[model samples]
Every structure is written in C-alpha cells, then in structure tokens.
Target: MKKWLQFLVLITSITSTSALLASGGIGEGSEGRSSQMPPVMNAKWKAECSGCHMLYHPGLLPERSWKAVMAGLDKHFGESAGLDAATRDEITSFLVLNSADKSANRRSSRINQSIPTNSTPLRVSETRYFISKHDEISASTFKRKSVGSSANCIACHRGAEKGDFSESQVRIPR
Candidate 1:
C-alpha cells in the first residue's frame, strides 16, 4: 500500500509539473510553440467569422487592426457582415485581448514585427510576414479552383482552422 501511494504521488507530481510548463508560467504571456497551435479561441468569433469565411485566429492581427475590422463589419471586405451590437462587442473584446501584438507566441511575435508601427492591416495576407512566407507561390496557383484565393488558408493548410500552419502539413491543392 505504501509503495502504491508513493508511485501515485510521483505520477501526480510529474503531471503537475508538465502542465505548469505547458501553461508558460503563472501570469506569464501566452507564447506560441512551433509544435502547438494558437491558444486563443472564442466561440462567438468562430461562429460569426466562420459564417462568412475561415475563422481567423485572433493572434493573426494586431489589436488596432482587429479594432478597425470590427468597427467596419458593415463594410467587411465589400460585404455586410454586421453583427448585433452585443455580439460585435464580445467578439471584438476577444480579438483584441488575443491579438498578435498582445501574444508572446513565436508566430504572433513575428507577425507583429513584420508590420510597420503606423500600419494596421485588416488582412493577414497583407502582412509582411505572410507575404514573405508566400512569396514563392505564383498568382495562378492561388487562383486555382481548389485554392480559391490567398485568403483561403485552409485550401493549402489543412490545419489552418486549428492555427497549425507548419510547412510540413501544407499541401496546396492542385
């Protein structure tokens, strides 16, 4: 019985330590790991954003960009994506709280660094980091029926919806 108790305690300690490390320390900023997906997700953001297109991770844009996008929902990319006031506020809060500028994740950090301090890009595709990464792809490839456009990340990145865009996992549709 004593031996079993010791073993249980040891297992519990290991599990607790692993979880703590994974959480990036108490009150520390959430950092992105190459092996893991973006950590922030909100149900309203998912439902509302995905209603028209892919549910972009909030960490993809800076807080200012998110604010601008949320404010202009009625004219969202030439379409009316207006949401109820309450819903819009909630989604905007979530996005700003988790925006790339506020994240410590490697990808978010890189994205933030790529943008000029004065610029607030509404589209992730317009960011220097995104453009540099996609510079090799030709325009014709993006126009493919299966690929649609640069905005359609899921067409090439199978795990884009989950915030996993590892190069190894990308398989651009022919």
Candidate 2:
C-alpha cells in the first residue's frame, strides 16, 4: 500500500475509535442529554440559553464581559434583545463563577486562550478548525439541503455533543 493510503487508514481508525468512546457507545449509558445539565446561572441567563449552534457555557466569558454583553443586548449585534432585570443578575453571577478561569473543560477555555481578539463572532463555526474543514466544499454543495452554510453544526457532524465529527458519523446529504 502507498504511504499516504496507510496514513489515511491509521487516522481513520483512531478517529472512529475516539468517536465511539466520546459518545459513550461502549459500556456507557445513554447518548442524548447528560444526567444533569450544567447549572444555569441566573434565571435570566437560563431563559436566554440556546441549545443549538454555539451552545457555549456562559463561563466562557469573564463576569465583566458577560455584564457588558447582557447590558448591550438591546442593540446586540444590530438586533433587539433583552432580559428582565432579575434574570440578568442570575446570568451575570453564573458567568462570573463558571468563566474560563473556573472551567475544567478544554473546549470552554480554548476560546479565551486562543481567540485573542474580541471583535469576532461567538459561534464555534467561525473558528479555524471549522473554516478549514469546510473550505473545500463547493458553493453548490453548500446550497444543497444536506449542507447549509459552514455554520450548521449538525450538517457534517453527527454526534457533536460527544465532540465527535468523524467520517463514520458524517451523513452528507445526497
């Protein structure tokens, strides 16, 4: 076999195994939803949480930044958004405690450490990993029903919660 072919096979093997492990398919319990969702910050924060797209933990931002983002929600990214005063406080507190510094998860801290600039989108789809993966996808392919913009997490990634996006899970819509 060619060297490149062998290398590709090796990578495929490792990726498949990792996905299975991450999804807990081996000897583990259920796949959908964890036994306990991470704690919600304030009621307000919980109210505004989104499960799809960038399901980022609020702790990704410093307390001060969260406060700023919450405060500016009225004109948030040129959109109207807001929360009740009480809920705002809850979100602020949650973010403060769980912010990157307090997080044990690598994904949560990765954004803060790597993304040095603050003038970027919050969604993980904008990151280098996401961009490179989708770079070769043709425009026609993107417009198809199977694949939307590069932002659609579930398009190429089947079981993302388990942090697995291998070919085994990929279901490129025909």
By TM-score, the best candidate is 1
**Overall local distance difference test of candidate 2:** 0.56
Error of 1 at 152 (Å): 0.4
TM-score of 1: 0.79
lDDT of 2 by residue, 115-161 (tens): 44554434444555445656777878767876666556566666543
What is the clash count of model 1? 1
The CA lDDT at 169 in model 2 is 69
Residue-by-residue lDDT tens digits, candidate 1, 82-133:
9999999999999888888887677788889999999999999999999999
**What TM-score number comes out for model 2?**
0.50
Poorest lDDT segment (10 consecutive residues) of candidate 1 = 27-36
Q: What is the lDDT of residue 9 in candidate 1?
A: 100
Model 2, position 126: C-alpha lDDT score: 51
TM-score for each model = 0.79, 0.50
